[model samples]
Target: MKTTNAYLSKTVNELKPSGIRRFFDLASGMEGVISLGVGEPDFVTPWTVREAAILSLEQGYTSYTANAGLLELRQEIAAYMAREFQVAYQPDSEIIVTVGASQAIDIAFRSILDPGDEVIVVEPCFVSYSPLVSLAGGTPVHVQAETEQEFKISPKKLESAITSKTKAIMICSPNNPTGTMLNKEELQKIAEIAERYDLLVISDEIYAELVYDEVYTSMAAINGMKERTILISGFSKGFAMTGWRLGFVCAPKEITAAMLKVHQYGIMCAPIMAQYAGLEAMRNGQDEVEEMRKSYRRRRNYMVSSLNELGLSCHSPGGAFYVFPSIQTTGLTSDQFAEQLLMEEKVAVVPGSVFGESGEGYIRCSYATSIEQLQEAIKRIRRFLEKQTS
Candidate 1:
């Protein structure tokens, strides 16, 4: 047998398995678990979007189109971004359709990072950023954003984290776990900082369409940001097409050109059928998106109110489908709370610490589930919390 290599890359050896995976795996074997641990939307892809994929299959558009994806799909993405988000792109030179926002993240990191270069990421953030940055031979510099700040990373926090070696910053608006969105003024501040420091902005806007009250700002839309930001978005959150594996990125011509080469070698294009579905979503899925957004808002309000009534203080999220509630009163660590809730109450939640160190003392409940399920989960949590407190 070959001996395990002692000289494994420090980046590879230091990385930990995703914290969310363990809770999901433990809950998987349980028969009655009511899972709110997943980040995916509970909604299915709209009928029209599904039909479009089927139509593509029927029309024999099953073969791989191009490394950058089909031109028509790119054009539709360009139009959709312009119409909905007020961002502009050349589509042909500045965009590459990806397998999902996950792949877009990977490609962007790979294209930009060199060994020892630092990428600043705000916590509690999506779980993949650090590892992805590491895999690209870069350091992930985490700036902890407090819940007192509504989990929004301030420009001051960012300023303090930047160093001479800082190469880029990863930003996720309508953020996961926290559901905190940076408002226009915040975006302006961030853009100004990036301009001053000459840092590349990798803006993850997958939840752009899901904001409740504040208008979503694409970093690329900010003045001086179009050239300095790599904008990543997908159909997963917005169009309820998670399994479709469709996403895209837009960047300055030079950056996009570099990303396309990496994408070509790593992932030729997003799935052809999914690309077709994504095209239809951009062109005609507006009403479906609006309906889902409205339902998510209702679920958000209901769940936030219920958790607060149960004595768990929840910050009302402006976007995304999660509620991060303080569970410190139960005198349980976040992981302990989540585990007991699953094992005893048959309800699944994710611990906040799964996102980062800043996430301790809290738990994430995805309101992407239906209102009925949301109500039932909260009821279970209330009973469990009462038992624990008593």
Candidate 2:
């Protein structure tokens, strides 16, 4: 009899599971673990959004929506994009609501990539980008954004990474793990490169609303970029609607049509209840979103200051709820620092190496939890570092 591994697709078997999951699994069921490992928002989905979903169910709207999602929700998404980012997308033909930003990312790759095509992925980025590109039968060429660069890729680095087989570039603003956001000027430089190279862009802006000191710019808003960019964002990060699993993609009609084929056959539509909740969020949840962003900003400030004070040497992140601090001074690798912290201090944080090689000496600590918890976690971390140095 053949083994299960033998029957697995080579690509699937070769794929490594997310390193974040490993730490989460270990921390689960452990007593008194203060976890900063996951990037999820600690805040509950707003009462209004939840109530909207409940109301939708009470009204007996439980059946499958249109494969492209409800017309109402799509229109709201279009309106929200235009209002927030100044990028125009027509409701009727240019949008597809998805299960989550993850699904949107997957379908975008499926829609545009052919086998052996290359996609330039910026790192340290979210873990899924490379694997998703590979699963789509494409090669993921990573362009490292070093810490000295504030973890933002320069246009020259991006241009140098392109080759004849390059088909797309994946960029996440207000980035994950590092919490670095690309400025409008930086995005314009990238836009120029994309146009010159004739490459598509998959811009992941899930954390756009969480920016603190800097304004978030949509790559689609840049000149000539709207036609060449596939914009992916979701309710998860911005609206704290992770469990609802609602997201959307905005692109040119041709690209949207192609992605719709994959989305239709695979997902049919985003959940009907979630779509209604999303519509409600677009309409009435902006204030709540801003409140959450402000809270994250406060926590981000506290965490960055505390981490640096603890001798961790963290850069001030412009957005998102995470602080990436170099642990090199502790004379430990990122994995070692995280593991030791979990073992000795019961504070779980993600090793930056899990994000990319450029993240080797750092660790990502999320400030999405409460201030009290942040204080306790930092105290424990400081104790652990002192012990290490001694």
Candidate 3:
């Protein structure tokens, strides 16, 4: 009989498991663990959005949508992008409704990358970026964003990662693990580099609706960037529809057509009910989205303050529900701090090193939980820090 490793693709067999899922798994087995590991919003999907999905099923509309997704939903997404992200797409030609933003990324990479092609993956980023690049038969060249730069990759650092084989650059803003968002000016700088280097930019804006202090600029909206950008977003974060798994991607028509083949073969279409829910969300879920944004803002403030007071150097992220805080003061590695804190205090956090080497001295804690849970976690963290010092 063949060995397990021999049976598997060497590419996948050699890859490590996601660090985020490992902590989430550990937390799941324990009692009374306040887990800040997963980045999902705690709010239920808005009643209106949920009702749309329910009513669709009630009306016997459970069939698969067009491979590109529902026309109505795509039109709504097109309009929403124009209004909110300052980008325009011909929904009929330049957009594809995906299973989720994650799938959009996967299809985009598979559409564009040839074997040995390179994608500049900015770090510390979501755990999936580099892996997805590899899975798509491209090499992932990581360029790190350290804490001193507020976790935003500089255009210089980005350009330095480019090579003749570089076909694309992948970015997430407001980023996961660290919630830093790049404003228009900063994005424009990267856009210039992409134009100069003739690189495609895959921008994941899953946390677009969660931004507090800065405006969320779509990468496609930057001058000369629209043609080179694959804009991916989903209803999961903005409309509290994580379970719905509805996402969309916008790109130039030619690129969209190429990605469509990958999407069609890999995922026939997004769920019809979720597409209906996404339609309702894009059209009428603004108020609920704002409400959630406000709540996350409050939690962001509280978590940042508490972590700093407890002697962990924390950055107040502009968007997203997570904070990357330094655990270096306690003289422990990110893994050590996270593991010890979880075992001793029943608080589960992901070590930042899981994101990349630059994340080694930090840990990622999500503020997607309620304030009460955050407060308790803060107390436990304080106690853990005290023990670390003593």
How many angstroms is residue 377 displaced in model 3 relative to the true structure, after the best TM-score fit? 0.4
TM-score of each predicted structure versus truth: 0.98, 0.99, 0.99
Inter-residue clash pairs, candidate 3: none
Output the worst ten-in-a-row residue range by lDDT, candidate 2: 146-155
For each candidate, the alpha-carbon lDDT, in order, equals 0.91, 0.92, 0.90
Model 2: residues with Cα > 4 Å off, grouped in runs: none
What would the TM-score be for candidate 3 when compared with the true structure? Answer: 0.99
Clashing pairs in 1: none
- For candidate 1, write residues 279-305 as lDDT tens digits: 999999999999999999999999988
Tens digit of per-residue lDDT, candidate 2, span 78-112:
88998999999998899999999999999999999
* Residue 386, candidate 1: C-alpha displacement in angstroms: 1.0
Q: What 10-residue stretch in candidate 1 is worst by lDDT? A: 1-10
lDDT tens digits, residue span 197-264, model 3? 88899999999999999777888888889999999899888788888888989999999999999988
